[model samples]
Target: MALSEAEWKRRQEEEDAEPAYFGMTWGEFDRLPERKQQETRQRLSQLGATHVGFWKDCTLGKCRRARRCIGFLSEAQYKAGYNAAYPPCARGEEPRRAKIYYDGICRLFPEGDEQPKYDGRRKTGEEDE
Candidate 1:
């Protein structure tokens, strides 16, 4: 059945209007409730998060919060962040706590390697033992 003319016009107007939550500004979009934010995030992740042909730009900030919940970044940016955080130990002391793994470990690095071996026995991170 056809919607009444008035009803159809109203639907068209509603479609033309910006979402009440998103309003015409990024600031207003940021003010949306957490529930709404999450919903929109999920929707964006589904659509904008895609890979096109050779011309495609994979760097769009289309992180999938539903999958990992940590947000997203291009692989290059990810590597830079990872390297900046876990640079080779400044003085060659084994990094006590790797930031990517243990952020608070930064405090241990300044303590110096001479402080003492953590345990009577020690092994490299890759060591089988």
Candidate 2:
């Protein structure tokens, strides 16, 4: 059924009020320091080079083990390894590092806001809230 204009406007406002992932929008991601952005892009590109193909194949139901992939052993398995190998930031707390890295990777692709939200505590002085 079609909604009235008032309902539609209210829904739009509610969506707009929703918090962004890691409390950051694409605009904020773009405004990060150039060095940080470059580093993030580089890390994401390297990750994509190594894993994107496999991930795509698995997601498209083209992999033999796609159905078996689950829980802690799922796609995040590679992410954990990547995080350990690359280590997003050297000077921040775990939560902050996770947020930065998560946001960094999310911003690397189109429709990034549709990516999963990073679940972590906000750093004391960061703008995330």
Candidate 3:
């Protein structure tokens, strides 16, 4: 059933109140310990928080299909750009761009890897460890 207009507005307000974080909601991120949050921020900086272009057959979903580097930016900047493009409660199927972005980062910086690598193969049957 369709939500009432008031209910829709309320939800929009709630989404607006909570910021966006990659792979999770802002509220979830905020609930983490203060030190953990700081560590996360620091870690992103240490990794350079570079934006990895979408994989050829990205497992997350259909990619944006751009044939060039998407340009590196800080996490904050990426989040802002994502929100501007696809805000919360956006009507229709969820876009894959954000998930692609997150998955790209993970692939580039898999745990224990001394340096990032470019892997464009599809992760059809791979599981996150």
Candidate 4:
């Protein structure tokens, strides 16, 4: 996704201010040798934060419909929904967002859709007051 110049500047400033990965800016982290990056990732993976955190962050920020439908679902259930929503991401497209998948998830689970209203009318089976 292409970010506007203002957004890009904001993100750069934010990253510069906050530590990313292991006490370094994301740029610094990226500049590390691939082996070092892999090592850090492996350590983060053992802590159960890398992949899980990434997806949760994505869902909360970018997948509004998917986020709304997340109520009352177990981790496994949510994962199933996510897989159904983002097959390409499941296949191997890690850390990428796609509008198509977002739409797919919304279609698969319409919890975010507006609810219907019922007029205050009595049914035939009910006793009239």
Best by lDDT: 4
Q: Which pairs of residues clash in candidate 3, taking residues 3 or more apart in a chain or in different chains?
A: none
Q: Candidate 3 residues 1-129, lDDT tens each?
A: 999999998996687558544565666777788645654553342232224333333322223354323233335544554332321211112344444335544566566857668777656655543
How high is each candidate's TM-score?
A: 0.21, 0.23, 0.26, 0.28
Better structure of 2 and 3 per TM-score: 3
Model 4, runs deviating above 4 Å: 1-10, 49-129
Ranking by lDDT: 4, 3, 2, 1
> Candidate 2, after superposition: displacement of residue 46 in Å?
1.8
* C-alpha local distance difference test of each model: 0.37, 0.43, 0.45, 0.45
Off by over 4 Å in 3: 1-22, 49-129
Worst 10 residues of 2 by lDDT: 66-75
Task: State the displacement of the C-alpha of residue 17, model 2, in Å, after optimal TM-score superposition.
Answer: 10
Each prediction's total of clashing residue pairs, residues at least 3 apart in sequence or on different chains, is 0, 0, 0, 0
The alpha-carbon lDDT assigned to residue 110 of candidate 3 equals 64
Give lDDT tens digits, candidate 4, residues 1-129. 999999999988787767667577877887788656655543433223222323344334333344322222225644554432232223224443233234343344356548668777766755653
Deviation in angstroms for 18 in model 2? 11
Q: For residues 14-91, what per-residue lDDT tens digits would candidate 2 score against the true structure?
A: 766665435655455566785455445444433432232223323324232543211112235344553332322212
